[model samples]
Target: MEPPNILSSIPFKQSPLNPGELNLTHYCMSFLLSIPWNDISVTGFEYLAKKYRLDVFSDTSNPNEVLLSLAGKIILIDVIIPTHGTYRDIRIALAFADATGEQYKNTGAEEILLSAIHENNTTLLERNVALLAMLDRCSPSVQQSCFQYLETLKSTFSLIYTSRLNTQAFNDETEIIMSAEGKPLNDNDGNLGLQLAFWKHQDFLYTAKISMNELPSNSLPCALYGSNLVAETPLKTSGEVSWLPETTMTQIPATMELLFEDYHIVFPEFGVQSLLDFLQITDLDLSENFLPYKTLLNLPNQTTAGYPSMNKSHIIYLGGIDIPSRSVHRIPYSHPRQILGIFQYVRQYLTLQTIFENVKLSSTRITATASLRLNLIMKQYPVIHIQYQELNKLSNVDPVIANVSVLPNGIVQLNSIACGNTPINEDTALKIQKMLQKTLNIGLVLEFAIPKLFNNQ
Candidate 1:
């Protein structure tokens, strides 16, 4: 007889996780995300939107945003925190993670992970096992966590990679901050010295600053400026990508080096590091394989505690080499950066000599913002999307794309798109509009079918 699929039999449905196991994971993980590491807090995520203008999502109601990824795939979600406090907010995310499992479900040490959490005093055996298992899978996020928790799981986990990400619009601001702050970048206060400071880069409107001091109070070797201590889980085929580099650049930080080292260490079969060491890719290669990193370079625009809006700023990285941060040793990539002087050498400047190809505007007259057109968007839903129509006209794709577009005002939107170039008869179009209207009329019933006993939005 074939061996039993223990995973499918035990932890999943057959032998359901007990109540206590569920609660232990949920509460513990939630507490972990909120207080992952104290030393490196560049900006509370809330500061990004109201003050710094780092737009990560269009919606304003639910703030805490998380990038859920498995291997090379990345999914961004603006989390709905069930509670107001940090510990509670993280718990909401933890619940979501438990529900979605995602990349965390594939781990070989499922029971081991659960046992570790249960072994701790913080864990409560009386809690529901189903809830704990659910949280372990999806929501609270599998990236950043407290020192004790992270250290405990280090043996099995690959590495948590936290890359400071933003759009190209914030490039100027990113360059300014990187330039101002050198190797020991956290120099805000005088003689005693401040951790970091925020500066506005006129070159780029969405400007901000971060320093690494608060993260490591004493013996901690790792210190980051607004960057979270993410845990990079191991994937079978493709590893998750926080951000992939677009072009070939040099004087890069220890971001790649650390990733290469840690990733290879965790999954030696992948053979990622030996190649770099043997071929000395660090010194010889300059390919388009590297782009995203958070070594005091680009800041996560709206994902943290302080940021405001999403898509408000584009980010550009100048140049930075990995250096030693004596204050924090855990981060081998924590080094001084060389944004100005080395940029010209490490970066290839754009030098397009060709002229424009061809373009012509249709003679069709553009309509003004008449009351009729404006009211069309405000009829049922509070938003209107313009890009889908443009893309449909240009690429000739599906015309019925639900592009959620919002006006200058901030309001929850629930509605439909206007009739576009889709070859739909008047009858079908009307039917969809009517059906959608009916669903909305049901008082907005969104649910998970079965009754789940946990926090709800």
Candidate 2:
């Protein structure tokens, strides 16, 4: 007898939502509804129902649950509004463990709901809650619509409103697993512990373990928004990146290892220089707020930061709007992403040499042992300007391929440089060498390879 086929033994099953078996059980979602008992204007809800021509049906049996029929699909949502409050709106939150489950299966429900929220002119807190409830909760088919619409809404809203939206939205697709065991500094009798969180995406993985010096609960509600206590302060945190990415270099010896696709860089000894570099970068004044988040996350889901989704990815730190004096000097683990994102924006305005000088002087030694990662996915390489002194002008000194690395002592090492198959005399090589050294204070070691010009230039 022939061996049984394992695949054929199992029954093929799929949800009727899509013929290809659209499974969205993992897309858990939560909703928050803040209704001021005194001011319950149904205008926005009415406008949305009228505009979409959606049929609304209230569950007579259960007052909290309501059903909406849209495009031949039923969206049954359960919301419980509080009957009483002192001086603020009563807040109620609903969680959908399976966003695409039978009860609430419509693909475009989030878009419709967001439109309703926008029309209602809801309070900032309520609006933010509603927005968070919908992030990564919709079906794949409706992602673009929901994301683009949110982008539009973000543009029209206040800079501070929904501050966490972009950060949360950008990282929505990446799931994080965390474990915590800690006590705040104020609790003298308690033991101070650590919190570890891990997130892994396509090309890389990262783990951050941090210890909180101050409890978040201790943060005062300085910024009040829509009757909710939304604190604008960041908790004091000290942590280390226990994995790759090299974005947050470690201050502890052998605490982390950075592994690129082809190169492996190691760091020894404590170095707060990169963190200092980061702080200096963040201190620079930015004329426009929220530009980094908007520019990076608002684009279509097809790409990230103007590069293919596979080629580019990001991790963000939603730092507090107002940094407390006590937490200012503390190395807050949750600030790099936003800092890096902002750096991406302001880097263009600054001179290249300035950045290079800072990186070179940083005590955080970044020395590579393996070869350079050949699979570089940059959008475009900046033009290399080498002033040729007009001594014996040789044809524009064509683009060259080189392996670049920063030495353990901070000097940049540009080795195995190649300028196509062309053979050059000592004078030509010496000229190229002198120009590069003069401009970048870096020397080169040549290795021949094909030279290619990019961007049609």
Candidate 3:
């Protein structure tokens, strides 16, 4: 026969209250019921109570009897805590019945207790009192453990609260100040060694001069100028003064000036409308890949160069008109003249012509019958001989041979072209040779007769 399951033998019932409705008493009772009380030592009970923050003392109560009384007290505390709701009458009735070993039907006391606890906020002191009273009735070990746990909780709470208060105080009292200018100024005492002056022009340009008693010890003194505040380097510096200004457009009613080390600048009729207009343009929601032609056309004439004469209709043609379309299919082969025209168009923009030295061509039936000559310059060879022949309709083979000779002018020449049994005519060959000489700047092959003096020697 199998040994009995001790937990199964013990009387345990599920609480009628829902999870949200359960109170501290329900939790405590559940915990107590789940433990194998017979196996747990007196010391273990004390340790558990302390760990759980239950106010139970080890020395004050009988270990066995205290367990039952502790359960009763937990019930009482749960009922008494106003926040948890008053189940005092129900608890007392249960206690009386249990004392007399009389069986009583469930009166929904657990549900009522849970409802009261959740609805109210009991004071910490009151909660502590309830916990202490509950632990006082528990086993000696349980009481000891509970009391220790509660004490530790209280100490931790106090420490965290105090630290938060100190941090708030420090943040409130501390103040940090930094000078926007390079150095501090004492203008009140009339020791004004630094001075800034401004001059304005009709074209909305301003010039500023900064005069100082001595040169700056650290990095060069920087001045911020412009309606939108741009940093400007000094234009020219004399013995004790420097000019810090830039030739930039400004708007009417202009107050823009150079700002440095507490020195102030004032200009007459400076305008800020231009800067605001620029900022507004910058803030526009424009497409990343495409420009908005309509937005550009709507800009003020003064804001854009040649805006008055710019045709708005032309903008539509310009917008995305130049962008290549994905839907357009590529032409694999075109008329040889058309291909040559494109090559010539591209070649006009090319600074170097060495890229065409050894042009690789795939023979296709589409351009097989067409004969074309291409000029190219080779860096290694003075002359290159290229021969092309069609073995059959399927394949046209071409072999390239470079005949290089250094000329007297230190130039490489490619002066020969031999087409073996190909469709190239005499005119095509002569054009090819001439084109090569012109493109590569190769000199003609010179013929010289040997002198009689050299023959006699």
Best by TM-score: 2
Rank by TM-score (best first): 2, 1, 3
Compute each candidate's TM-score over C-alphas: 0.17, 0.20, 0.14
Q: Candidate 1 residues 1-457, lDDT tens each?
A: 2111101112212213663243555445445543422210113223222221123333334455333211211222222322233322321112112224443231222333233233431222112222122222221234432211222223212121112223232244344333322122211111111122122222322111221222111222232212222234222123332221222222211121011101111101112232224323231112222322222222222121110121111111111112111110111222222112222111110000000000011122323111111111222222323222221133432323332222111112334433345343445444544433323211011111001211111
Kindly list the per-residue Cα lDDT of model 2 for residues 198-306, writing each as its tens digit.
Answer: 3222344332222211112211111100111112321112321112233322221111111111211111101222333443423211121112211221222121111
Q: What is the C-alpha RMSD of each candidate to the true structure, in Å?
A: 26.0, 22.2, 37.9
For candidate 1, the TM-score is 0.17
lDDT of the candidates, in the order given: 0.22, 0.25, 0.24
Off by over 4 Å in 1: 1-27, 32-332, 338-457
The digit string of per-residue lDDT tens for model 3 on 1-457 reads 2111101112233346753343657567757644532212334434434443444432324332323122332222222212233323222111212224443332333343233334332232223223334333331332223223323323332332233334432232111001001111211122111111111112322111112111111111222112211123211132111222334412211111122222111100011112223222121111221222222122121111111221111010011112211110111111111222222211221111121211222222232321222222223322223222222321433422223332312233334433333333456445544444344321111100001111211
Local lDDT at 344 for model 2 = 27
Error of 1 at 81 (Å): 32
Q: For candidate 2, what is the lDDT?
A: 0.25
